[model samples]
Target chain A: MSYNKRNDGRAFDELRPMDAKVGIIKNALGSAMFRIGKTVALAAVYGPSELFPKFLQKKEEGLLRCTYNMMAFSGSGTRVKPGPSRRSREIELVTRNALESVLDLSECPRAVINVNIELIQTDAGTRCAGICAASMALADAGFKMKDLVAAVSAGLVGDKIVLDLDYSEESFEEGAVDIPMAFMPRTGKIALLQLDGEITKEQLREAIKLAKKGCKQICEVQRQALKEKYKTEE
Target chain B: MGILIEDKQIVVPGEEVAEGMDFLPAPGTFRDGDKIVACQLGLVNISGRLIKVIPLEGAYMPKRGDVVIGKINDLTYSNWFVDIGYAYEAALSMKEATTEFIERGAELTDYYTYDDVIVAKITNVTKSKSIDLSMIGPGLRKLQGGRLLEISAQKVPRVVGKQGSMISMIKEITNCQIIVGQNGRVWISGTEIWQERLASEAVLLIARKAHTHGLTDRVKAFLESGSKK
Candidate 1:
C-alpha cells in the first residue's frame, strides 16, 4: 500500500476539525450545534412533555423520539428536499436508539423527549455528528444521563483504517468499508455499531480500537461544550 | 462486593452504585445481576441499608393529589380537557368542576371558558394515563386577572424554599398574590402593574438561580434593587 496524501491533507489516523456548542437555539429544552470539518448539524431537545397516537404510549417507560432532517441545500449535489427521506428516517432511528440507551426515560412514564437534528451542511459524518450533538443538548437540557453518546465513523481506505472519512473518501468509487460507531464514554460501552461493507476480522478489530480512541476524544469535546454552556463563575 | 460509589457522589445513568447483594436498591437505582446500578444521573443518597439517587434536574411526573395549574384546552358537554403542561390532559368533569348543581342544558361555559386558567387538584390518574381533576377544594379556583409564568418543573421546589420562606417573602415584599404550582407554573397578581412586574422579576430570578446557595438572600436583594427603580 502506497502512503499517498489524501485530498483534505488529514493523516489516516487524524479526524477532521470538530466544533460543538450547546444552547444555540432558544425555546428548546436543550440545543446544540456540532460541526465536523465541512459537515454541520444542529440538534434541539424538547419535551419530556407528551407523546401522541395514544395507543403507542408505553406504561413502563416514556419515549425518546427523534426527527432527523437534512436541509435541501446541505448536500453538494442538488438541493435535496425539505421533508424526511428514507435516509434521514433511518438516521433518526439510529440517533433515537443510541440516545435512549443513556436516558432515564422511565423517570417520566407517560411523556416523551423529542430530539430534532437538522443537517445544515454535509460532506460526511452527519449522523455521527448529530448523535454527538444530540447528547450534548440532552445534558444541557439538564437531563440526568448515564453519559454522552460520543460517536465517530471510520472506514477502511486502501487497506488502512482512517479515523473520520470526508465526503470524498466515504464515497470513493473503488469502494470502502464504512464503520459508524457510538459509545457511552462514561461506561466505555458500545451504544451503536454499524458496518456498511466487509472487512477482515483482524482489520475490524483494529478499526474498533481506532474508533474507540476517536470517540473518547470526541467525548472530551462534548464535555467541554457542556462546561462552556454552564460555565458559571465560582 | 461493596459499594463502588461514595455517598452523596453524583453518578450518571447506568453507572454502578454497588457491586454486591449486600446492599438494598432504592428509587433511582435498579438491580443488574448482583450489582446495583443507577437508572438516572443524580446524587447518590445513602441511608443505613438503602441506596438511592436524587436527580438534580428533569421534568415533573404528575401524580394523584398534585395541585397543578391547568389551561382549558377543549370543552364538551360532560367534561373539560385541560393541559397541565404534561403528557396527559387532566379531565375536569362537570360534577367535580363546581359544587353548585350544573343543571342539564346549562351552558358549560357559564362556569369556565376556553383558555381560562384554573387551579385544580388531580383526583385520579387512570390505567391508560387519563388524569381526572376537581376544583372542589379551598384555594382551588379560576385564576382571575393574574399573569402566568412558567419555569422548569424540576426547579419548583427551590422557588417555594424551606417551609415557604422564599415565596412568602416575595409575596409580602411585593404585596403580590403568588401561587406556585409543583409543576412549575406560577401565578403573580397584584393591584398595581409595577408591583406585578417586581414580583415576576423576583420569581424569575429565583428560578434562574435556584440551584445556587443563599438564593433567598439573593432574591431579597434583587427585589430591593428593583423597588428602587
Candidate 2:
C-alpha cells in the first residue's frame, strides 16, 4: 500500500505530539479528552451504583464495564461503522481489563462503574489512545484506584523501531508489528498486552524492551495531562 | 530459527525483560525475529513463559466485596432499581432491604420513594451484567436530609484514599456524617447547619484537586479556613 511520511521526520520509535484534557464532560461523573498526534479519544466514567443481574454479583465489590466507539469522522479516508461492531467489543474488553487492574473495586460495594471511550480520530494507535483516555476519565470520575495507567503503541518498521505508530506506518509493509500495552509506572505492573504482526522470538525480546521505554515516555505525557487538568480547576 | 536472526525474540534497546527468560514471538505479529520497538514507556512483565507490558494511568472499576453508596431511581413490587452507571440498572430486592415492617401494597412508595439515595451492598451480579444489591448490613442506611455533591467515579478513590483516611478526616473535622454514593453522589449532614456546608466545600475541593499529591494537608487547611469563615 502507498504511504505518506509524517511531517516532523521522527525516528521509527518516536511518538507524535500528544495532549490530554480531563473533567471536560459536564454530564459524566468523570470525563477526559486525549490526543496522540492526530488520533484522539474521549472517555467518560459513570456508576458504582446498583448492578443489573443475570450474572453473579459481588455484594462486596463493584463491577467494571467499558464501551469503545469510533466516530464516523474518526478515520481519514473511509468512515467507520456508526454502531458497535465486533472490533469495538474487543477494544472494550481490552480497555476494561487494563483499567480494572488499577482500580480499587473493593472500596465501593454493590455498584457498577461504566466507562465510554469515543474515538475522535483514527490514527494508527486508537486502542492505545483509548487506554489513555479512559484512564483520565476514570480519574475524572473520582473512582478509587491504586494508580494511574498510561498506554502507547510501538512497532518495528524496517531496521528502526518506532514509537506511537501512525496510520500510514501501521499498515505499510516495511515489515512492522504493533504492540499496545498499559502499566502502573509506580508499581511497575502490567495491565494490558496485545500484539499484531511478525517478529521472531529474539525480536520479541527487543520489541518488549523498546515498548517499555516508550511507556515511560507516555507516562510523562499522562502526568502532564493530569497536571493540566488539575491546574484548570485551580 | 537461527537461520537469520538467531534467538527469534526481538528485545528493544532500553527495554527490560525478566531475568533468565528468553523473549518469544508476539502471538500473531512476529516474523522469526523482526524487531519491535517500545510503544509507550512502561514496565515489562515476564511471568512464566508470557511477556506483557502495562501502562500507568486510568480509572477504577467496582469488584466483588466493595462497599459503595447509591441513589434510588425507581422501585417495583419485587425490587428497587438503581442507576449504578452500568449498562443496566442494579436491583435491590424487598427481601434484602430491611426486616422492619415495610407496607406490602401501595404504601411502598411512601417508604423508599424515588430519588432517595442510599448506601447498600452488592450481593450478586449476573453473567448478562446485572447487579443485585442489599441494604441489610451494618453502616447501610437510607441517605436523606443533606446536600448531595457528585464527583468522578475514578476520583472516588483519591477522595477516599488508603483505608478511609481521607473520608474519616472529612467526617471528624467537619463533624458530619458523610455518605458517599458509589455512583458519584455524596450526601453530607451535620448536627449544626454550617458544619454540613463546610463538609460539602471540603469534599468539592478534594474532588477538584484530586490529581495533585498530598491532598490531605490541603483539604485540612481548606476545612479549617472555611470553618473559621
Candidate 3:
C-alpha cells in the first residue's frame, strides 16, 4: 500500500490533538468537553440523585444510564436529525458500559446517575470521544471511581495501523477496519471493544496494543482536566 | 504487593496503588488480581497492613454504626422515613425509635413531626440498600431549637478530631451546645444567635480547610478573632 502518510500528516501510530475541560456545565453535578482532532463531545452527569420508577431499582448498587446524541449541525452538510437513531442507541449502551466499569456505583445505592454525551462535532472517533468525556464528567461529579478510563480508535489502513483516524481515513479505501477500544488505566482492563471492519488475527493483536497505549495518553489528558477542576488551595 | 505510591500521595482515578499480595486494599481502593488500585482522587493513607484512600471530595454515604442527623420525611405504619441527604431514605422503626410501646392507632406525628431533625444511629444497612435507624442509644433524640449546619461528611473526622478534642474545643470556645452528626450535620445552640453563627463559621473554617495541619490552633484563633469583633 503506497501512502503519503496520514491526511493530518501524523504517523501510522500517532494520535490527533487532544484537549479536555471539566465542569463546563455549571448546573451539572459533573460536566466535561473533550476534543480529539475535529471530533468534539460534551458530556454531563446528573443525579446520583434518585432512581425513578421504583420497581427497577437495584438493591445493591446505583443505576447508571447514558444518553449518546449527535447534534444536527455536527456533521458536514445535510443536517442529521437530532434524535436517537439506532446508531446513537448502540453507542449509548456501550458508553454506559465503558463508564460503569470504572465508577464505584455501589457506593450510592438506590440512586441513579445519568450520564449524557452530545457529539457537537464529528470527525471519525465520536464514540471514543464520547466515552472519554462522560467518564471525566462522572469523576468531576465527586463520584469515587475505581480509576479514570479513556478510549481511542485505531484502524487498519491497507496494511498500515493508524491511530485516531479522521473521517477521511475512516471511510477511505477498501478493507480499512475501525477498532475502537475503551480501557481502564488503573487495572489495565478493556471495558468496551468494537470492530467496525474486518481484519486478520495478527492485525487485531497489534491494533489492541497500539490502541491501549494511545488510551493511556488520552487518560493523562483526562487526569489533567480533573486535577485542574478539583484543585484546592493547599 | 509493594505499594506503588507513597503515603499521603495524591492519586487520581485509575492510578495503581500497590502491586503484590504484600499490601491490602482498604476503603477507597479496590483490588485487581494482586494489584491494589486507587479508584478516587485523594490522599493515600497506608495504615498498618492496609492501604486507605481518603477521598478529598466526600459526598456523604451512610455506613453502619454511623451517628447521623436525619429529618422525618414521612411516617409509615411502623416506621418513620428519614431523609439523610442522599437518595436512599432510611427507615426508623417505631420499635427501635423508642423503647416505649403505645397502643395501636396512635398518631405518628405526635412523636416526631414532619421535618423534625433527629440525631440517631444507623443500626443496620441491609443488602437491598434499606437503612435501619435507632434512636434508643445514648445522646440520641429529637433535636429542637438549634441552628443546623452542614459540612462534607469526609470532613467530619477532622472536625471531631482525636478523642473529641476538636469538637470540644469549639464548644468550649464558642460556649455553645454542639452536636455533630456523622452525616456532616451540626446542631449548634448558643444563648445568642450571633454566638451560634460565630460557632458555625468556626466549624465552616475547619470544613473548608480541613486538609491543613494544626487546624485546632487555627480554629481557636479564628473563634477568638470573631468573638472580639
Best by lDDT: 3
- How close is every model to the real structure, measured as TM-score? 0.88, 0.58, 0.85
Query: Model 1, range B1-229, lDDT digits (tens) per residue?
Result: 7989998665655568898888898887878788888765456888987999875555666778889999999999899999898766789999999999988899889899999999999998766567899999999999999799998787787889899999999998899999988778999999989999999988888777654568888899888888778
- B161 Cα displacement, candidate 1 (Å): 0.5
Residue A67's lDDT in candidate 3? 95
- lDDT string for model 3 (A161-193, tens) is 888888888777766789999988757799999
Q: What docking class should model 2 receive?
A: incorrect
Calculate each model's fnat, 2 decimals: 0.32, 0.08, 0.58
Model 1 chain B weakest 10-residue run by lDDT: B54-63
**Local accuracy of candidate 3 as per-residue lDDT tens digits, B40-61:** 7777899987988887655677
The top-ranked prediction according to TM-score is 1
Interface RMSD of 3: 2.3
* Candidate 1 vs 2: which has more TM-score: 1
After TM-score superposition, the amount by which residue A204's alpha carbon in candidate 2 deviates from its true location, in angstroms, is 2.4
Candidate 2 chain B superposition, TM-score: 0.70
1 against 2, candidate with superior DockQ: 1
TM-score of predicted chain B, candidate 1: 0.88
lDDT of 2 by residue, B6-94 (tens): 22222221232333324442321122223322222222334444444332222334344555677678887888887655545678888
